[model samples]
Target chain A: MEKKLKIVGFLCNWCSYAGADLAGVSRFQYPADIRVIRVPCSGRVNPLFILKCFQEGADGVLVSGCHPGDCHYQEGNYYTRRRMMMLKDLFCFFGIDKRRFHISWVSASEGKKWADVVTAVVEDVGAALRGSEKQ
Target chain B: MASTENRSEKNTRRESIEQFLYRLLKEGKVDAVLVPKRHPGGNIVSPVLISEPSQIKGTDPLAPVQTVNAASIVKELVKEPVDKKIAAVLRPCEVRATIELIKLKQLSDESLLIIGYDCPGVYNVKEYMHGIENREDKEAFTEEHIHDFLSGDGDLVRESCRFCTYFTADSADVDIAWIGVEPPGIIVAARSEKGRRMTGGMNTGDKDAPTVRKETIGKIEARREKRQKSGIDNLLDLIQPCIRCYNCREVCPLCYCKECLLEPEKMGYTSERYLSRAERKKQIRMPVDTLLYHLTRINHMGYSCVSCGICEQACPMDIPLGTILHVFSKKIQSLFDYVPGRSRDDELPLTTFREEELSEVEDV
Candidate 1:
């Protein structure tokens, strides 16, 4: 049996966070593995913050901001994308599996897409947990 | 053994020192000489800028073990208007660090005529002092031990000097490069117009001997071999004796921080917790940051470690800080064709953003 993996997700309030809230109102079911922290803009995440979370033992991390040009702050998601891209590259250099982290462009209106992304990421993290245990 | 290269230019350091001072004083180029002068006390020497040549003739090239990084000094000087060019005899690392400081806008090239040396390596103040303190005549003990202390076959060099590969001066406006070829002097490879112009009328000739450079490299490698396993053991060992003291920063020539991120009064510093319950009270200041202290300084100036080996020399506990610095500098600079301090203008990889760099990227 795979142990429950604790996943932390940084969801931008205008997009992913609102979409997550909509999933609840729409009665959609997703895995409870993720604990979401809402931020005004995804660009607030620094690589140091991510490294700190990993160092303090988070099994998986998901960062969902608005779609590329659809940031509530107009350019916030674009900046977040570049920073997270660099952060993931750093993690890969340390031999962390790509499957353990997720970044997506979910919009405020895309509640169904948010539910689908959560289901997929949670299952992927669950599978990774199993694989790491065997090794 | 005194490097055989020391003999050829028999009066090279002396001549170069005289020419630089003459240019600075007679031509009004610089205000002073920021080097160590010896006192009768034997162990105590301080960083002073000599305006008069008579004052600098007493410069203890082997004693005082300079801890003030000439790199940071150049940076400080750059802040003011250049009333005159200040010719500084900096270690290769300090020269490179000065170039970097200039590049970083901390220093200006106009105010400095960097006189760099082919460093044979210097001793930690404490260790050299101990050797002196244990002997009958402190000055004689230091003079006698300079060879044994720096020689690889003799007592181990300060760990910083052992791992450093750039003992020769490769970059500087004006260099008395330790060609490490024959003895008593360097072959003087003029890499810059400033160096070439300075030695224009001299009998300085080309080094047709490739074997000499290779031989010097062979000596350096022999020392580097003994320096292995020192990197890991040294960094881990720094946890003790570090005491979170910022003395290394104060002594370091490159560690110029008007407002450092590590200062507790800066408002962002978080209090650290210690693992040992018995040692908890002793850990309040948190050994400040063994990793960040190394990492941030490297980030800020990795491209400039001239391998001066001063950071380790200043460590109170004798931590081999310079070895760890060189390790990271070596790994980081391999990506850029640019070796730190080798050039005054190479842009740092981290500081510059490239539109087409295609640097390491993770696959989706």
Candidate 2:
């Protein structure tokens, strides 16, 4: 059997974490690859945390927060938006595969969307790893 | 007019600057002046805080060497609200870094007067020391450097300085300009109201800086911009030699964190944790997280990086950190239309955010 790819998911407590919980309650099937870590808000996800995930041999990382203007504590995800964009740019510049890292918005009501985001991220991370191995 | 002519009569630019500083002290315009001067027996030039008037001799602001970015020293001098004003004569990069420090709240400029100068780039410390040792008249080497710089011979300066666009003090209160001036005399041009107040009685030369100075600076900037287009593409390979000495962080004026996450103790690695990490990878790099350290640092401080090249200067492995960080920070700063050290009013990129900006970063 092939070893399982470890994908770290940081979900904001009020929105994304609730969304993931809702997905489980509704029996919405998604990839089992992600190991979810609950965070207070998406803004709590430091860029260092994402980098540390990669450094610790995580195959991929996903950060999910509330939609802009929908934060439990207003404007947390807004700052996260700017920080993640700069981090993504820096990662690309350092030759890190940009596809392996992902960011999305999944609100408490969006259980189906949470499932979709995970499935897509798992597929992307798998493809990216396979592509790198061939090279 | 007599003082202007007398200044021109001085043998070298160093003597004229010394005279001006001496007068500033004697006239009690400033309580103390922080300027770079050689140590008692060594050629290494470092920032010295001189309160007495007679101690201004041997002070060389135009020295083509920077052992440490003087902003760090300025931070120490004015960490608390100071009662007496001190004038700091600094290079353009130092002035920019000082401005950033002030904005970051790492420094208090309450009793600080910044006097900036037109820089003619600098050699790395080793090259500068070698040149000074070979030269009989130490002052003559600076004159030779200026002459070479004016004539477009920038081959000898450090790589960062060669491609530096901000080689003059546009943001400084009072600028001591020597580039493109006739007869090699310094021009003291006050750029701000505070600068005007500070330089009210001082007479270095004609207050109106020549039009040629702007044109010369424009030419150098254009040349540097062209060189900057081909930035360091292989940054990972370039930083491979980094021994994790933290020299870059130590020397970076903007890296004023009292508790750094990059410290080994902060990582809290145990013997079993190390073994597990190696087991997981089948093998692992011993001094782990070198890449992680660099990336995290850039994320934390890239917005505020002044690119003084002091980090590059302090690197033991001689990594091209200055050029890499300069190139990286330029991109990051441009994303938010933020220029570090450009002004005091502009908010740091990470500190403030606009409601309707960066919509592309969020995936719906």
What are the runs in model 2 whose C-alpha is more than 4 Å off? Answer: A1-4, B1-10, B203-209, B229-233
Please give, for residues B1-364, the per-residue lDDT of candidate 2 as tens digits.
0123343345677777788889888888899999999777657788899999999999988888998899989988899998898999999889988999898899888778889888888888988998888665666677778777776645768888888888888788888887777645788877777877877867465444578977888788887877774445677788788779889888888889899989978755889998998898899775777778788788877998877888888988988888888888888999999888777789988878988888777553
Docking class of 2: medium
Model 1, residue A6: C-alpha shift (Å): 4.5
For candidate 1, what is the TM-score?
A: 0.70
TM-score of chain A of each: 0.93, 0.97
lDDT score at residue B285, model 1, on the 0-100 scale: 46
RMSD, each candidate, Å?
6.2, 3.4
Using TM-score as the measure, the top candidate is 2
Clashes of each: 16, 0
Worst 10-residue stretch by lDDT in candidate 2 chain B?
B1-10
Q: How is the predicted docking of candidate 1 categorized under the CAPRI scheme? A: incorrect
Position A133, candidate 2: lDDT: 92
Task: List the candidates' TM-scores in order.
Answer: 0.70, 0.93
Q: Candidate 1's residue-wise lDDT over A1-135, tens digit each?
A: 546678899999899899999888898888888889888888887655555455446888888888766788877766566556544543433446778888887887888988899889888877877797799
